[model samples]
Target: MSKTMKISESLIEIAKPYAEAQHRSVPKQIEHWARLGKAAEENPELSIVFIQNSILALAEEKAGMATPYSFGE
Candidate 1:
């Protein structure tokens, strides 16, 4: 369920390269940024790098790419 909305040209320009690089549509790239911002706001103590890695880890898990972690004895 998506709706049409107006966004700044500057934002579109900024998102274009990132969207292409990430293999996501411009809207999806913006959505990903929004999600990152939301998580950052909610967990002020967490670094952006950590948040990004966590998101990637979750995505990998959802896509069945995660493996069990083995701790060294």
Candidate 2:
């Protein structure tokens, strides 16, 4: 369910490098930023680093790349 919308050329240009670096499409890069911004706005007490790391950890878990952490092992 994707829709076409107008976006600034400068924004697209800014997203290009980040998109490439993250191995995502330009639209996905913008979406990622939007998601982070939304999370930050909703969770004012949470740091951006924590939010980003949490998202990464969730992704890793979903992709079956995460392992259980041992306690004091």
Candidate 3:
């Protein structure tokens, strides 16, 4: 099956910078975002746990349990 849809130029402009930084085209960037969104929608608990873990990670940093970013071999 196949379908056609319309997308706005303004939206493309908004996504251009991110796509360029990631070495991808605008359409690929949009498709990647769409896939992530679909997965999040299908698994509500996954999104909730992701948010919770992010908050906990920040708290750990504030408490000095985590080290600052350092590159090593």
lDDT of 3 by residue, 1-73 (tens): 8576677899899889989997889987887667667767877778755754665687799998997687894
Range of the 10 consecutive residues with the lowest summed lDDT in candidate 3? 47-56
Candidate 1 residue pairs in clash (backbone atoms < 3 Å):
none
Best by lDDT: 1
List runs of model 3 lying over 4 Å from the truth. 1-4, 48-73
For each candidate, how many residue pairs have backbone atoms clashing (under 3 Å)?
A: 0, 0, 0
Pairs of residues at least 3 apart in sequence or in different chains that clash in candidate 3 = none
Candidate 2 per-residue lDDT over residues 1-73, each given as its tens digit: 9788999999999999999999999999999999999999999999999999999999999999999999999
Candidate with maximal TM-score? 1
Overall local distance difference test of candidate 2: 0.97
Instruction: Report the C-alpha lDDT of model 1 over 1-73, residue by residue, as the tens digit.
Output: 9789999999999999999999999999999999999999999999999999999999999999999988994
The alpha-carbon deviation from the true structure for residue 38 of candidate 3, after best TM-score superposition, in angstroms, is 0.4
lDDT of 2 at 63: 100
Two-way TM-score contest, 2 vs 3, winner: 2
Please give the ranking of all candidate structures by lDDT, highest first, separated by commas. 1, 2, 3
Better of 1 and 3 by TM-score: 1
Quote model 2's TM-score: 0.86
lDDT of each: 0.98, 0.97, 0.77
